[model samples]
Target: MRTSIVFLSALATSVMGANSTTYTLPAGFNVGLVDSSERSAWCSAQRNTCPDICQDGTRLNSCDSNTLDFSCVCADGSTPDVTPFKQTVPFFVCQANYGQCINSHPDDAEGQRTCKKNAVCGSKNATEEADSSSSSTTTAASTTLAMATSTDSTASQTSSVAAASATTSNPAVALGGDMTKYSTGFMAGLMFVAARMIL
Candidate 1:
């Protein structure tokens, strides 16, 4: 009985060692000429680590094998749709069912006008005209100049501008002009002639 037990132990060890050999699989794991589609999965307790599964070319795909097969996992961003196609021509699904209305020319549309009722929509040619118009409008709407508690910056700015304009308009201050300096020189030359005549 001890001899038979030792023989069985050696036989089991030899079988395990033989199954440990490296397996070389073909491309896409296909073993051709053998109908893998018809072959039933030889599942066992040891098949918990089975390498491959056979797939079908039908609506229902191949089955997966795990240690304890629980539930199927749906693919990413995909749920099983009962209505795969609207009418088999494939219309858009989950579309927005509301109408949208937006005025392309928003500035002139929706009860708004480009310009006021009588005013023309145009551009000003001159900056001075625009400034004068704006200033006149402000002056017409007020009765008195508002008293300034702060320093008068605009007054100083106007004075500087007046001084610049006066300098440019009166460029012949010390050099004299045709009216005053020329007349004074003529009077002096006439006096010199008179003095020479007296001598």
Candidate 2:
């Protein structure tokens, strides 16, 4: 449970970033669609052409956080290539399905090219509305859960930022279950705050 709180905090932190599409990821996980432009651009510079494909559950060498250069990254925080890859790999921006899909326009700036990120809890229409209608049998708990979600979304939605939160009874479980989502470490950070509130 404590570990879940930490993850929530991390999610919150990721959501704090402006313009990022944040979402509720499972415990110990946070996915976000951030502007990987620098990394993407660097790859383009190296390959001299933007990649047109990216498969979900696959890591593409694109940005280096430490150096602000391209590096390999995955949803689970894997960075196989700390530096740019000697060879180009599959790279695509986050699409609407929330899974890494074929880039319709890989060269476009963040949020310009639209695609579905699979079931991201915070995506434009993927959000769940926790309310009195829930059948969880914990009325107060449900309301608290709803409030936490509302708070995060209300705070981040203006910029269309995807934020994630959970209810008191189950901090380890992500509040929304219907969508795949992505974002920076911000969503976890926001969720941490929410979890702390529950504690």
User: Could you say which candidate leads in lDDT?
Assistant: 2
Error of 1 at 121 (Å): 73
Worst 10 residues of 1 by lDDT: 89-98
Model 1's alpha-carbon lDDT is: 0.32
Q: How do the residues 69-112 of candidate 1 rate in per-residue lDDT, one tens digit apiece? A: 11111223122221122211001111101000112234545423
Tens-digit lDDT track for model 2 on 27-93?
Answer: 3221234445644454464232212111123233343322233433344444332112222322222
| TM-scores for candidates 1 onward, in order | 0.15, 0.16
* Winning model by TM-score: 2
In candidate 2, which residue ranges exceed 4 Å CA deviation?
1-41, 45-56, 59-68, 82-84, 87-199
